[model samples]
Target: MQPSRPLDVVYDPLYTTSTSHNKYEGHKRRVVPNKRPISIKNNSGLVSGPERHKYFCRPVLPHLQAETPEVLYASAHDAANIMSISEDLSASTRSIGMQTMYRDSHAQTDPFSPEYVLPEGAVAPEIESLTNLRYRKGLPVTQAEIRMIEHNRKKKALKKVLPPMSDEASLNLRKRMMEAQEIMDLKFRENEIDEAHARRIEALQESLAEREKQSQAINSERMRRLEKTLMLEKEDANRRNQHDRIKELRKLANKRQRIQTILNQGSKKRDLIEEYADYASPVYAPQMRNGNLVRKSPVPEVQFKDHQLMTLDSIRELEKNLPPQIRTSPKNQFLKRAPLMKKSRDQMTMETHLLNVESAINKQHVQGEEKLPSSPYKGQYRAILQRPSTPNYAPQIAEAGSEVNALRLLQRLIRGRAVQNMMYEGKDRRAELIAELRESEEARRFLSSSFQVPAEETEITKSAFSHVEGEVVSELLDVLQKELIRNKEIAKVYDFAQKAAEDRHQREIEEGARRQLEDLARDRHDQIYCFVTDIHRSTANDYIDSIFEDAVEDLTYRDSVVQSIIMTKVIDPILNILEEENSEDTIVKDLVSSFLFPWVQKHHTQDQALLEKRKYTSAIQALLAKVSQSMRI
Candidate 1:
């Protein structure tokens, strides 16, 4: 026919439907019979139900089949099995037959498919043919090949065409193209290099800016803190200076107060002295004058009375001339001698001078007048004068001696006035001094209360200076001496205290030095030594060890010696001198017994080797025996 047509293939969905229904023929739906004739129910003579149903059905319903879950599940399973079988068959066949069939279908003419026609209302452009080009024999006419051919044909058509520019212009155009490409490449390289450099520059700038900001902040903070510190320091310094000035003012005020007090005391003393001088001047002058006027020579000249001597001799001759019996007899001799012994020479002279006294006494005696005694030397003479003596004359003489003793006592009273005056002077001076001191103390107290020291440490500083001025050792010695003399028990207590303090001090020093040496040994491995040399050395190492031990022993001995010196020379002597009750001999014995003897015993006991080497044990025993004997004494 028009060119042998290929066989047409048709698909019949009705045949598939009929065959599917036959397979499920027993499960088909049955029609339901109408049980009653169709009738309209009249409501107000209108067909409302059918009319409303027709109105509701006016809108189109979607023509989609509703699928049950079982149908959808079974259909999905069947499709999955079919896809798996198709995939397996396609994999085995490599889909070559399918691809051939698809190509064939794509080439069929159908208006609905893209393979049927070109696009609507679109036309292909016209192409001009080349006349002077020779055809290539074996070139394939693919689209690309066709494009190449068209390009060659265009070149042949333009074979007679001249260049639009001269040779120079063309060369310039080629050069320009190369130059543009070079420029683009250079720009790209520059962009890449500058990108890294730019990033580095940006980072450095940012770092610099950050550092500057931090530096400025630190500097500002430091300056602010420094300013605050400076202000505080300046304020503190000003406060200290003010305190110093105040302290100086207070001290000056105190000094002025002390000076004023001293001046007032002086003025008061002077006034008192002037007042006392009024009573003292006149009385002292007269007493001095009377004393000078009545002054007598301490020694008296010796003189003898001639008349009294002659009378005494004449009396003795008269006594010798008396009868031998009366002279020998005790009663007559006593009677003769009593008047002679009783009457003094002065009384005889007074009797001789005043002869009337003897004459009157004799006349009064004759007339029973009081009989006065005659002198013993004048008794014989008195017998010649025929004078009588009174019996009461002996009592009068005893009374006269008593009166003389009273006068002597009066003289002693006069001598005691000098001692009273001395006592008065001492008491007066002490009173005035005490008054002045009291006034000074009052002034000092007022000043101290009124003006305080500026510094808290100012009082301590002043006390320290005062302490430097006051020698502590001298004060301690004075106190010790006073206590020893005043109270023996207190003195013993103080002595014990002093000994305890000294022992404590020595122990502290020893311990401190020991600690220091231990530390030094730990730190530097060194030792300190004190030594006494031997005359000869033994083996070297043994000698060295012996020397070290000897050195330590010597040091111990030296320490003992130092302790002895401190106790005996410094401490014991101080105690002994101040001990008022203990006699010198007793103190010496006590010291030797209590201290020295014990010390010797300890020394001998401690140094057995030395005692043996020196053969000193016997001597020590002897010395100890002597010491024991001395202590007993």
Candidate 2:
């Protein structure tokens, strides 16, 4: 069976009232320490076990019924009992509110907090008695009452222990204290006088020091100013002398240069004034030829107004010939225009909406049938009077305007301002004609179909002009034969030329392909060369380092000879192989182990030679590895 949730813990009303309402305010008296915050789960349900069941009994929910007969019957009975108990509890709780039961609980705690402490004698006996009678409550002592009780107890105990002082002894003690105060006052005055004297002496010394510091600062400032002035005067004098000497030297140098120039080229020497005077020409003057120094004619100055007027005229001309303007604003858009002329057909003929002819015909046929007698119809019909076919007719339309207008004729013949204007007018006329043709139903119907020559015209023309005279035919044949012979010759020449062109184009294409191949080859060659150079440059230092390391290791003559032999044979060959395009790790290893190792072993069987050989081979391997790293391809 499942258990119900435990009751919530409620704080005692007396404790709540005693506790400070404002948590922020500081308490003068030490507050009664709270051991810990009250937990609703731990402290709730003070009355537990069978004692709790006597009052606020909560029934446990019955377990789910099982298939077994015994368990199922027991569960049914338990559920029934639990349900009845819950209903009764709910009824009781409804009458006496849940909060009233919580308030009636006996469990209570007190903190004696100072906030709820009442003034002395504030609660009269009569009021306390009335509260106890009406509310069935007892007055509990406030925090103030507790403190007062404690203080009075302490005071009574102290009064029984300590005796009061006599009046003569108190007066004598006061007199001694007064005499001691006088002596202290005299000593304090003497100390003040000493401090004042010392302060005066210190002030005098400070004043003297301040005066000395000011005088020294003033004297130093004057000396610095005097030195600066003298230094500036000396610099000015030196600068003036330098300037004078430079001027004199410059004048001498100029004179010497002028004399030298005159002697060498026989050209006239001019001073700054003369040089500037030669440039004294009007600002608006035309530039002259270098040697002539004279213009053949002066350039004419165009006026702004005339220039602007010419530009404006060109702009206006361009604007006048511009294409039709487009309407940008819908509000100002062009409205549909009235037809240029009245439509030729009537409104009824123009209407495209088709009428329901079947309805009309059926109505007419019904009326006719109704009017006629109903009779058995025969297959044969009597011959009736034939109706004459409607005479083929068309409306005879007269021209609306005068047949001949001299002014209109003259206007049509008048030449436009330019050929462009004439073409524009022609284009406008054609556009108008096309629009009119599209607007006309009959014309549009005729134009929608493919056009063909009239059969009558074709027959007439074929018969009339099909035959040619013998002489003319013979002449035409001769001319054609001559033309065909010429065309044949031309075709032969064209064929040869085309073949030549094709051959040349093929050669050019081949040449371009060859050149591209050469360029790619050259680029690859250059890249390889740069890679080789980088490898050589980067390995040069490593080679030197290896040789140095080898020299340090090998001190004897045979070792030196072995080193030289290794350098000339092993290292050089390995480097050459590393630079080669087909160089690989196997090839390098073969060069070092197969060729160099056997040669070294044959030349020198000593241990040092063997050691040097190993070092050289290792160095060669290192060099090859470094080169391999630096290799681009």
The window of 10 residues in a row where model 2 has the poorest summed lDDT is 126-135
Global lDDT of model 1 = 0.59
The residue ranges of model 1 lying beyond 4 angstroms of the native Cα positions read: 1-175, 191-199, 268-633
Query: What lDDT score goes with residue 584 in model 2?
Result: 81
Candidate 2 clashing pairs, residues 3+ apart or interchain: none
> What clash count goes with each model?
7, 0
Model 1, 1-633: lDDT tens digits are: 552432111122233343434543333322234354468443685447634544432233454433222222222235687798788887846633222322454652212211112233544222212211222432223453465455545544443343445589876775676576567557656865676556755675577679989999999999999999999999899779856865765575566556445444433223433533454432223245433332332223546676753777888978887998877756433334554543485467446545744554464455344333343232222111111232244567777997889999998998799789998999897997889899999989977874665665678878897887788867888999987788988778899999998678656655765687689887553322211122233356687999999999999999999999899889997887768767889878887799788888888888987768667778888899999999999
Per-model C-alpha lDDT, please? 0.59, 0.57
lDDT of 2 by residue, 1-633 (tens): 642522111322222335547342334222455466676356574767755545842255565632222222322235687798689887845554232322345644322211122334443222221221212222255553444455545544544444335687766765676576567557656766676656765675577679889999999999999999999999899779856865765575566555444333322222433432344432223245522244332334444565543687887876677765532324666888866543433333224212333444454565445433232232123233232333322232234235446556666666444666888889887997877776796756655552565878667756665554556788999999999999999999999999998678656655765688699999999999999999998899899999998887776767889999999999999878767846588677876898888878877768778898999999999999999989955
How many pairs in model 1 have backbone atoms within 3 A of each other, for residues 3 or more apart or on separate chains, i.e. clashes? 7
